[model samples]
Target: MRRPSGRVMVGAAVVTVVLLVAAAGGAAWWRWDTQRQPRVDDVVTDMNTAVADAVAAAGEDAAVAVSPVVAAADCRLGPLRPGKIFTGKADLYTDPGGEDALITTIERNLPPRYAAGRGTAVAGVRPLQADIGTVTLSVRRLSPGWLAVTARSRCSLGAATEPAAPTGAAPGITAVTQLLAAAGTRPAGITEQRLRCTTGDIVTISAVSERTDTGDLTDRLAPALPSTARRFTTGDANRISYRDGPVSVIVASSDDGTAITAQHTTGC
Candidate 1:
């Protein structure tokens, strides 16, 4: 066999080195992607189990509780879209006999941040847990006697994605309409209402209570509003109230149906 020349040997060696480096780089990228893929199923399962366990331990009358740390984990590691999050509410029928004990158990076991979200005044807490891209848990009591537990999972998606548009009618008119419907009344007095869509494309509706106001309708209805509708406020005169509720919000994409929340108002 002919002996290989020095220049030819050097060139072959260079090519081989380049190939090895390329292969190594590809392998590293693949490993990173595999690791980064959110473990949605596992996280969700864990969240479900945690919630169930908390509820079971606390018993039927127990109020709900949530953990902020768990929520952060669910948001950072779960499978939901980045920046998107999950939230839930549970209604618990209060049994007079078990109410006190249940509330005690929830207050002792559930996390504090969650309790605050549910409005501590309400008695009986419900537990909530989630694992998507994020997790959040909270508990609260409702007026007219009901307990609520909520959980949220945040998405990892960044700010670039445009938020979804408002779904129902404009907030000022539609929110009032929804409140009336919930309160079992007819829409009246609302006119020339306009809504502004902000950062999250959030829609806010504000109006002054009309002369026909019969009760503290706005205050009564605020709590009942959907979770998407947040940061509620009343006007200076107490004659006007406003609700900054979502015109459109994202929930889990499931076969059952999309979950929607509406702002509830009584006066104005």
Candidate 2:
């Protein structure tokens, strides 16, 4: 009888020791898991602040104050190539106003693009949680201060979708288009203002204002072109040459017209 009782006591002691070891192992793992994640408070705060600034800048007549609440925050951290991505829901509260109008106002106020240090911010407003709108925001890293080019969808694996290759046109063509959008058609007299991109090892961009003062056009456009590039002038012809990544662009112009050429190959 004494021996059996002794054996039972030893069995209980062994079981207790096993349980203690398991608990300690679990605690260690929990600590490691928590440490692996990034500190996200700063990111969340910046996003919230962006929303507030947008609202304040709107200055709508039907003014309504908005408050944002972030929920279900999930973030993925990586090294260099592409940076971090943070996704969550942004809930907005506004003073009593029609939902549609409030939504429209908020959308109008939101920044077209928020530079999140090479990250993308995708916040979609939807009528969720009892007719109040909620925005699911996604911030993905691009380079150092811009959003990712490829948008995030529910099915994406967090990899940046490769951008489609250009149609072999000089990049300057796009720059000229944007400039035109801002400068608009030359003041009345300039009838034949033109821009052309000829692609090759050296992409050439030509801007001509027929029968118009090239000086006026150059003055208007020179301000629009990159000021950091090395600038040169010859008589009526002004030239700004610079390297944009692997491509070298030389923009030459006069009061009559302008020509921009870019090259990526050796010599010529």
Q: Deviation in angstroms for 78 in model 2?
A: 22
Per model, how many backbone clashes are there? 29, 17
Give candidate 1 regions above 4 Å deviation.
1-31, 62-83, 87-89, 95-101, 109-136, 154-268
State in Å the error of residue 56, model 1. Answer: 1.6
Candidate lDDT (C-alpha), each: 0.38, 0.33
| Candidate 1, 1-268: lDDT as tens digits | 9999999999999999999999999899767865666443334433443343334334433222221112233344334333334333333334343444555575565544333222333334343332223455544444323345454444433222222233466544665555555434544333331111111111223222322333444554556456644332222212112223213211111122221122322111
Question: How would you encode candidate 2's per-residue C-alpha lDDT over 28-61 as one tens digit per residue?
Answer: 9767755654444434444334444333322322
On TM-score, the candidate that comes out on top is 1
Q: What C-alpha lDDT does candidate 1 achieve relative to the native structure?
A: 0.38
Highest lDDT, which number?
1
